[model samples]
Target: MHEVKAKGILSAQNGMNIYKGCTHGCIYCDARSTCYQMDHAFEDIAVKVNAPELLEQALRRKRKKCMIGTGAMSDPYLHLEKELCLTRRCLEIIDEYGYGLAIQTKSDMLLRDLDIMKRINQKTKCVVQMTLTTFDERLCQILEPHVCTTSRRIEVLNILREEGIPTIVWMTPILPFINDTEENIRSILSACRKAEVYGIMTFGIGLTLRDGNRQYFYQKLDQHFSGMKERYIKTYGNAYQLPVPRGKELMKLVRQECSDAGIEWRTEKIFEYMHQFEDKEVGRQLTLFD
Candidate 1:
C-alpha cells in the first residue's frame, strides 16, 4: 500500500473513494477494465492519506447537508483499515457534521464501526449496502476469494436490521453457466428478505466482460470451471454486456419474489432512495415557512 495526497475527496454527486485499486480478488471486477486507467497494480492499493481532511473541508463547505457515499470502486473495510483507520476517521467527520452516510462493503470488518454507524443513523440516515453474488458458500469462496462468505454477510445484514439501520443488497454480476440458476437467485433473495433489506439492486442475470476484466475472468474460469472460458468465447465474442439465456426468466422470478417479500427491486427507486437526503429539522422549518 502507498499513500498519496489527494487534491479533492468527494465527487460532484457526493461520493468518495478513499482508496484506489483493491485487494479483493473478485474475478469479475469491472474496475479492472482498462477504461478506468489505473497506473499501478490492482492490489497495490493507493491510499488517500488526506481523505479525512479533504472530506471534512468538503462537508463544511456544503451549504446544504446531503448523504455522503463511499466504497464504489473499492471496499473501505479492507484489512489495512484495521491499522490505517482512514475510513473510520472519515466516518467521524461525517458524524460530526451531522450528514447522512451510504457506505458499501463486502467485508464484515464494518462491524468494528458499528457504534459510529448507529450514531450516524440515529442523528440522520445511514444506509449500509452489501453485495451478494453467489449464495453457495463454497462457490462464494471461489468467486470472491478474499472477502467474507455469503452467510457471514447475511449475519451483518441481520445485525444492522436489529439496530434499525436500513440495508440494501446488490445482487449482481451473475456469471452465466456458473451461477445463473433459479435456485441461486431464490436463495439470495430469501436471505435478503429474512434480513429485511430495504432493496436489492440487480441489473439482470449476467455479468459484463471487457478488455482487462474479461481476460482475468476468463483466466479464473479456466482455473475453476475447466473449459468454461472456451464456452464464453464461443458464446459471447467481443460482447460487453453478456446476458444469460435465462435472463428474462430469472428477472421475472426476482421481481415476483421481491414483490412477495415487499423488498424494493426497481433500480431507479433504489438509486433515488440512496441519493435523496432527508432531514427532519429542515422539513419542519420548510413546513413552518409554508
Candidate 2:
C-alpha cells in the first residue's frame, strides 16, 4: 500500500473512495477495466491518507446533511484497512456529524465497524450493501477468491438485520455459460430472503464485457475454466453487454421472487433509496429557559 494525498474526498454526489485499486481479486472486477484508468497495478492499493480530515471538512461545511457513500471503486475493508483504519476514521466522522452512510463491500472485515455503523444508523441512516455473485461455496471462492464466501456474507446480512441496519444485495455480473443458471439465481435469492435484505439490485442475467474488462475476464477464464475464453469469443465477439440465452426467463423469475418477498427489484427505486437523504432537521430552537 502507498499513500496519496487526495485533493478532494467526496464526489459531487457525496460518494467517496478512501482507497484506489482493490486486493479482493474478484476475477471479473470492473474497477480493473481500462475505462477506469487506474494508474497503478490493481493490487498496489493507493491509500488516501487525508480522507478522514477531508470528510470532516466536507461534512462540516455543508448546509444540509446527506448520506455519505463509499466503497464504490474499491472495498473499504480490504486487508490494508485493518491497519490503515481510514474507513473507520471516516465513519466516525460521519457519525459525529450526523450524516447517513451507504457503505458497500464484499468482505467480512466490515463486521469490525458494526458498532460505529450502528451508532451512525441510530443518529441518521447507514445502509450496508454487499454483492453476492454466486451461492455455491466452491464457485464463490473461484469467482471472488480474496474474500470470505457467500455463507459468511449471508451471516453478516442476518447480523445487520438483527441490528436494525438496513442492507442491499447486488446480484450481478452473471457469467453467461458458467453461472447463469436458474438454480444459481434461485439459490442466491433464497439466501437473500433468509437474510431479509431490504432490496435486490440486478441488471438481468448477464455480464458486461468492454475492452478492458473483457480481456481480463477472458484471461481468467482461460486460466480457471479451460476453453471458456474461446466460447466467450465465439458467443460474444467484441460485444459490450453479453446477455445469457436464458436471461429473459431468469429475469422474470427474479422479478416474481422479489415481488413475493417484497424485496425491491426496481432499479430507479433502489437508486433513489441510496441517494435520497432524510434531513431529520426537527430539533427545537435554542432557549435560555428563563
Candidate 3:
C-alpha cells in the first residue's frame, strides 16, 4: 500500500473512494478494466491519505445534508483498512456532520465500524450494500478468493438488520456458464430475503468482459475451470456484454422472488433509495418536545 495526498475526496454526485485498486481478488472485477486507466498494479492499493480531512471539509462546505456514497470504484474495507482505519475515520466525520451514508463492501471488516454506522442511521440514514455474486461457498471462494464469502456477508446483513440499519444486496457480474444457474440465483435471493435486505440490484444474469478484465477473467477460467476460456471465446467473441443463455428466465425469477418478498428489485428505485437522505433526528427532536 502507498499513501498519496488527494486534492479532493467527494465526487459531484456525493460519492468518494478513499482507496484505489482492491485486494479482493474477484475474477470478474470491472474496476481492472483498462477503461479506468490505473497506473499501478491492481493489487498495489493507492491510499488517499487525506481522505478524512477532505471529506470533513467537503461535508462542512455542503449547504445541505445528503447521502455520501463510497465503495464504488474499490472496496473501502480492504485488508489494508484493518491497520489504516482511514475508512473508519471518514465514517466518523460523516456521522458527526449528520450526513447520511451508503457504503458498499464485500468484506466483513465493516462490522468493526458498526457503532459509527448505527449512529449515522439514528441521526440520518445509513445503508450498507454488499455484493453477493455467488451463493455456493466454494464458488464464492473461487470467484472472490481474497474476500469473505457470501454466507459470512449474509451474517453481516442479519447483524445490520437487528441493528435497524437498512441493507442492500448487489447481486451482480453473474459469470455465464459458471454461476448463472437458477439454483444459484434462488439461493442468493433466499439469503437476501432472510436478511431482510431493503433491495437487491442486478442488471441481469451475466457479466461484462472488456480488454483488461476479459484477459484476466479468461486466465482465471483457464486455471480453474479448464476449457472454460475456449467456451467463452467461442460463445462471445469480442462481445462486451455477455449475458447468460438463460438471462431472461433468471431475471424473471429474480423479479418474482423479490416482489413476493417485498424487496425492491427495480434498479431505479434502489438507486433512488440510496441517494435519498432521511433525517430521523428531526422526528426524534419533535417527539422529545411533544
Candidate 4:
C-alpha cells in the first residue's frame, strides 16, 4: 500500500473514496476495468492519506447536510483498513459534524465501528450496504476471495438490524452459467428477507463483462469451471450487458419475492432512499423537547 496526497476528497454528490483499488479479489470486480486507468496493481491499494482531514473540511464547509457515500470504486474496509483506520476516522468526522453516512463494504470489519455508525444514525442517518453475489459458502469463497463469506455478511446484516441501523443488500452480478440459477437467487433473497434488509438492489439476474474485468473473469473461469470461458466468448462476444438466459423470469421472481417480503427492489427508489438523508426521529424528538 502507498499513500498519496489527494487534491479533493468528496464528489459533487458528497461521495468519497478513501482508497483506490481493492484487494478483495472479486473475480468480476468492475474496478479492474482498464477504463478506470489505474497505474498500480489492483491489489496494491492507494491510500488517500489526507482523507480524514479533507472530509472534516468538506463537511464543515457544506451549508447543507446530506448523506456522503463511499466504497463505490473500491471497498473502503479493505484489508488495509484493519490497520489504517482511515474509514473509522472519517466516520468519526461524519459523526462529529452530524452528517449522514451511506457506507458499503465486503468486510465484516465494518462492525468494529458500530458505535460511530449508531451515533451518526442517531443524529442524522447511517445506512450500511453489502453485496451478496453467491449464496453457497464454497462458491462465495471462490468468487469473492479475500473477503467474508455470504453467511458472515448475513450475520453482519442481522447485527446491524438489531442495532436499528437500516441495511441495504446489493444482489448483483450473478455470473451466467455459474451462479445464475433460480435457486441461488432465491436463497440470497431469503437471506436478505431474514436479515430484514431495508432494500435489495439488483439491475437484473446477470453480470457485466468488459475489456479488463472480462479477461480476468475468463481466466478464473478457465481455472475453476473448465471450458466456461469459451462458452462466454461464444455466447457474448464483445457484448456488455451479458444478461442471463432467464433474465425476465428471474426478475419477475425477484419482484414477487421482494414485494411479498416488504423489501424495496426498485433501483431508483433504493438509490433515493440511500441518498436521501433521513432525520425523522431526530427532528420529531427535538420538536417534542423544545
Candidate 5:
C-alpha cells in the first residue's frame, strides 16, 4: 500500500475513487486492463490520503446536492481500508453534506460503516452495490479469491434490506466455459430475490477481456483451470468481448426472473436510479410541519 496526495477527489460526474488499484485478486478484474494505465502494480493500492478533505470541499461547492459515487474502478473497502479509514471518513463527509451515496464493493468490510450509511440514507439516498459472479461457493472462491464469497455478500444484501438501505447487485463478467451456465444464473437470481435487491446489473451473459486483463485472466486460468487458456484463445482469438455461447438464453432467464420478482433488470434504469438523489428528511420535515 502507498499513499499519495491527489489533486482532486470527485469526478465531473461526482464519482470518486478513494483508492486506486485493488487487492481482491479477482481473476477477471478489468481495472487491470492496459487501457487504465496504472503506474504501479494492480495490488500496490494507491491510497488517496486527501480524499476526505477533497470530497468535503467538493460537496460544499455544489449548489445542489446529488449522489456521490465511488468504487467504480477500485473497491473502496479494500483490506487497507480497515486501518486507513479513508472511505469511512469520506462517507461521514457525504452524510454531513446531505449528499446521496452510491458505493460499490464486494467486501463485507462495508458493514463497518453501516451507521454512517444509514444516516445518509435517512437524510438522502445511499445505495450499496455488490457484484455476484459465481453462485457456487467453491467456484466463487476460485474466481474472486481474497474477497468475501457470494453467500457472505448475499447476507450483506439481506442486512442492507433490513436496514431500509437500498441495494443493487452487479451480476457481471460471466466467464465462458466457466461460470456462464443457467444454473449459475438461476441460483444468483434466486439469492437476489431472497435479499430483495432493488436491481441487478448485467452486461449480457459474459465477461470482457482486453489487453492487460486478458493476459492476467489467461495466466490465472492456466494456473487454476488447466487447458482453459488455450480454449479461450481458440474461441475468442483476441476479441475484446467474449460472450458466452448461451448468452441470449441466459440473459432471457435473467430478465424473466428479475421481472417476476419486481426487481429492476434494465441497466439504464438501474444507473438512473443510482444517479438520482432523494432527500427523505425533507419529506419527513414537511409531514411534521403539516
Candidate 6:
C-alpha cells in the first residue's frame, strides 16, 4: 500500500472511498474497467492518508446532518484496513458529527466495527450492504477469491439484524452461463430472507463487460472454466451487458420472492433509504416533548 494526500474526501453526494484499487480479487470487478482510469496496479491499493481528517472537516462544515456513504469503488474493509484503521477513524468522525452511515463490503472484517455501527444506528442510522453473487461456497471462492464467502456474509447480516442495524443485500453481476441459474438465484434470495435483510438490489441476471474488466474476466474463465471464454465471445461479442438467456425468467422469480418476503426490490427506493438520514434521539424528543 502507498499513501497519497487527497484533495477532497467526500463526493457531492457524500460518498467516500478511503482507498483506491482493491485486493479482494473479484474476477469481474467493474472498478478495474478502463473507464475509471485507475493509474496504479489494481492490487497496489492507494491509501488516502488524509481521508479521516478531510472527512472531519467536511462533516463540520455541513449545516445539516445526512448519511455518509463509503465502499463504492473499493471495499473499505479490505485487509489493509486491519492495520491502517482509516475507515475506523472516519466512522468515529461520522459518529461524532451525528451523521448516518451506509457502508458496503463483501468482507467479514466489518464485525470489527460492530460497536461503532451500533453507536451510529442508535444516534441516527447505519445500513450495512453486502454483495452476494452466488450461494455455492466453492463457486463463491472462485468468483470472489479473496473475500469472505456467502455463508459468512449471511451470518454477518443476521448479526446486524439482531443488533438493530439495518442491512441490504446486493445480488448483482450474475455472470451469464456461470452463475445465472434459477437455482443459484433462488438459493441466494432464500438466504437473504433468512437473514431478514431490509432490501435486495439486483440488476437482472447478467454481468457487464468492458474493455479492461472483460479481458481479465475472460482470462480467469479460461483458467477456471475451460472454453468458457470462447463461448462468451461467441455469445456476447464485444457487448457491454451480457444478459443471460433466462434473464427475464430469473428476474421475474426474484421479484416474486422479494414480494413474498416483503424485502424491497426497487433499486431507487433502496438507495433513497440509504441516503436519507433520521435521528432517533430527535424523534424520541419530538414524540415525548411535543
- The global Cα lDDT (0 to 1) of model 1 is 0.90
Q: Which of the numbered candidates is closest to the native, going by highest lDDT?
A: 3
Where model 4 places Cα greater than 4 Å from the true spot, the runs are 281-290
Q: What residue pairs are clashing in model 6?
A: none
lDDT by residue (tens digit), candidate 5, 1-290: 88999999988888999999999999999999999989999999999999988898888987877888999999999999999999999999998888889999999999999999999998888999999998999999999999999999999999999999999999998999999888899999999999999999997778898889988998999989999999988998999899999999889999999999999999989988888877786662211111
* Each prediction's TM-score versus the true structure: 0.96, 0.95, 0.97, 0.96, 0.97, 0.97
lDDT pick, better of 2 and 3: 3
- Tens digits of per-residue lDDT for model 3, 1-290: 88899999988888999999999999999999999999999999999999999999999998888889999999999999999999999999999999889999999999999999989998888999999988899999999999999999999999999999999999998888999988899999999999999999998778888889988999999989999999999999989999999999999999999999999999989988888888785763211111
> What lDDT tens digits, residue by residue, belong to model 1 across residues 7-59?
99998888999999988899899999999999999899999999999999999
lDDT (Cα atoms) of all candidates against the true structure:
0.90, 0.88, 0.92, 0.90, 0.91, 0.91
Which pairs clash inside model 4?
none
Native-structure RMSD, model 6: 3.2
Error of 3 at 174 (Å): 0.9
What C-alpha lDDT, on a 0 to 100 scale, does residue 159 get in candidate 2?
Answer: 95
Residue pairs in clash, model 3: none
Which segments of model 3 are wrong by more than 4 Å?
A: 283-290
lDDT of 4: 0.90
